[model samples]
Target: MPPLFKHPNFVHFWIGQIASSFAFQMLSVGIGWQMYDLTNSPMALGLVGLCQFLPQLLLTLVVGHVADRYNRRLICVCTRFTMAMTVGILAYGNITDSISANMIYLCAALLGTARAFEMPANQAILPNLIPNELLSRAVSAIASAREISVIAGPALGGLIYLIGPTTLYLSSMSCFLVSCVIMFFLHYNFTVKTKSPISMEHLFGGLRFIRGNKVILGSVSLDMFAVLLGGATALLPIVAKDILHTEAWGLGLLRCSPAVGALLMSIYLARRPLTHSVGKIMFAAVAVFGVATILFGLSENLILSMIALVLLGSSDMISVVIRSTLVQLETPDDMRGRVSAANSVFIGSSNQLGEFESGVTAAWFGVVPAIIVGGVGTIAVVGLWMYLFPNLLKRDTLEQ
Candidate 1:
C-alpha cells in the first residue's frame, strides 16, 4: 500500500474531511447568497461571519481544556452531530419557505458554538494518526483536500441554489451525517493523562508557552495579519453580482477558482515534498497571494478575476502547509490541545474577523476599494513580520 493510505485512521479522516468540506463549501456559498438575497448589504454578510466566530473566541480556552481532558474522537463525533442537527434546522426553515435572516443568524450562532469545540479536537488529533516522518505530507494532503472542496463545493452550491436554497441545506445536512458515521470508525486509544487540578494557573501556562515559542508565534502572527488584511472572500457576493455581472453559476465558479489553483499546487507539493527552506517559501507565497489579491481587486472581467483568485488560492496553500507543519513539529503531545486552540483562535479570527473587516470596509469604501486596500495592507504586513522575526526567517526546519 502507498504510505499515504497505510493508516486506516488517516484514510478515514481524509475521506471524511473531503466529504464534509465539500458540503461546507456549498453551505458557505449558500449562506452568502441567501444573506444577500434577503438584505443585499455587505455589512449583513459580514454579520454572518461575526455570528459564527464570536462563539469560537468565547469558548476557545474552555474547549482547549476539555479536548485535553477527554477522548478526542468522542468530541469530534458529538460536534459533528451537533452541526448535523443545526443544518437540519436550517433545511427545515428553507423547505417550509419560512427562512428568515434572523433564523439563519441563529443557526449560524449554534454552528459556531459547535465549532468552538470541534476545531481544537480536529487539530490535536491529527498528529496521533500519522507518523512524524509523514507529517508534512499529511498536512499537504489535507490542504489538497480542502482545496478540492473549495473548487467543487461552491460550484455545486451555486447550481443547487438555482434550484432552491432548501436543496443546498439538505445536501449539507447529509454531508454532516456522513461525517458523523465516518468519525465513528476512527479507532484511537488517546487517553487524557492526569495532571494538576484545573485552575487559572494551568490555563495561563498555555498562553505563556505560546508566548515563549517565537517560531510558532511568528508563523501564526504572519498568517493572522496577512489574512486579516488581504481576505476578500466576504466581498465575493458583491463582486459576483455588481462588478462581474455574473449569475449564480458564475458566482460559484468565481468562488471555486482559488481552490482549484490550490488543489493543483497541493498535488505537486505532495509528490515532491519540501522538507527545507519552508520559511522563505512561505513568505514568498504570501507575498504572491497579496499580489494576486491586488490583481483580483482591479479586474472586472470574469476570466481575469478567476485567474487572480486561482493565484491567490495557490499561494495561500503554500503558506498553510508550511505553517501547519511547523506547528505540528514544534508542539509536544501534552501541549498539543492548548497550542492547537491558540492556533484556532488566530486562524478563526483572521478568517471570520477578516470577513467582518471586509464587510465594514466594503460598506464604507465600496467593494473595489475595500479589496484593493486589503491587498496592499497584506503586502505591508508581510514586510513587517519578516523584519520582526529575523530568527524565524533564518530557521530552515522545524527539527530545530
Candidate 2:
C-alpha cells in the first residue's frame, strides 16, 4: 500500500467518504437554491438549517451511546443507506415536479437524523482502521479527499441544475448509493454486542470527560463557538444571487472556491505536517478566518469575494486539522464514540444554529450587516477563548 493508502479499510473508507461528500455538497446546493426560489424569503432558508439540525440536537446522547455499543462499520453503512433512501425519495419528487417546500423540509429532517448517527460512527471508526503512527496522515488524506469532493460536487451540481433540478437530485442519489456500497467492504469489524443498561450517568460521561480535559475542552469549544459566529456559508446563496448578481453557475463556482483552497491546504498538511505550536496555530487560524469573513462581507466584486472565501477556507482547514487531531489523540478508544458524539452535537449546533442566526439577522438587519457582525463576533470569540484556554495556547506541539 502507498503511504497514503496504507490500510485497506482506510482506502475503502476514504473512497466512500469522497463519493458521499460530493453527494452532500450537491444536496446542499440544490436544496438551498430550491428553497430560496420557492419562497423567496430569507427566513425560509433559515428553516432549512433548523429542520436538518433538529434531529442531531435532539438525539445526540442516544446516538452516541448507540455508536459506542454497536458495530461502527455497520452503523455507518446503515445510516448512509438510510440517507440514500431519503435522497432517492427527494429525487423522485423533483422528477415528478411535485416537490413542495414542506416535502423538502421533511426530507431534510430524515437526512439529518441519518447524518446524526453517521458522523460519530464514522469518526470513531477511523482510529481503529489504521495504525496510530499513521493516524494524522490518514486524517489529512481523508480531509483532502473530502475537500476534492466538495470542489467538484458543487460545480457538477450547478451544471446539473442547468440541465434540470431533477437531474441534480438523481445524481446525488446515485453518489449516495455508490458510497454506501463501497463502505461495506471494510474487513475489520468492531462491536459490543450487548450494551450495559442505559442511564443518565452513561449518557453524560462524554461531557464529563471533555470538561475535565482543558486541552480538549478548549479546542472543541473554541471551534464550536468560533465557527458558529464566523460561518457565512448559510448566507452564501444570498451573496451569490442578490449580492454578486450571479446565477446557478456562479453560485456553484462560489461554493467550490473555498474547497479549492481547503484542498490545497490539506495536501500541504499531509506532506509537511504541523509539528510546532499546534494550539497557537489553531487560534491564529481562527482569527484569520474571522478577518477573512469580514473581508468577504465587505467585498461587492465577485473576484474579491472569492479571494476572501479562499482565505476563509484555508484558515478553517488549519483549525479543522488541528482540532480533529487533538480530539482523537486525546481520547481513549473505548470512549471515542461518545466523545465524538459530543463533538458532533457541538458541530451540528454551531453550523445549524449559525445558519438560523444569519437568516434571522439578515431578515432583521440585512445580509451584509449580518455577515459583518458575525465576523466581528468570531474575532471576539478567539480573544476570549485564548484567555480561557491559556494551557491550550501555551502548548507546544501536535506530538503527544
Worst 10 residues of 2 by lDDT: 187-196
Q: For every candidate structure, what is the RMSD over all alpha carbons to the true structure, in angstroms?
A: 3.0, 3.0
Candidate 2 residue spans exceeding 4 A from truth: 31-45, 94-101, 161-167, 191-194, 233-254, 297-301, 356-373
Q: What is the lDDT of every predicted structure here?
A: 0.85, 0.85
Error of 2 at 301 (Å): 4.3
User: Estimated TM-score per prediction?
Assistant: 0.88, 0.88
* Highest lDDT against the true fold, candidate: 2
* Model 2 per-residue lDDT tens digits across residues 105-218: 999999989998999889988988887757777778889998887777776887888887888888888888888898887776675555678899888878888999999999
Instruction: Report clashes for each candidate as comma-separated counts.
Output: 0, 0
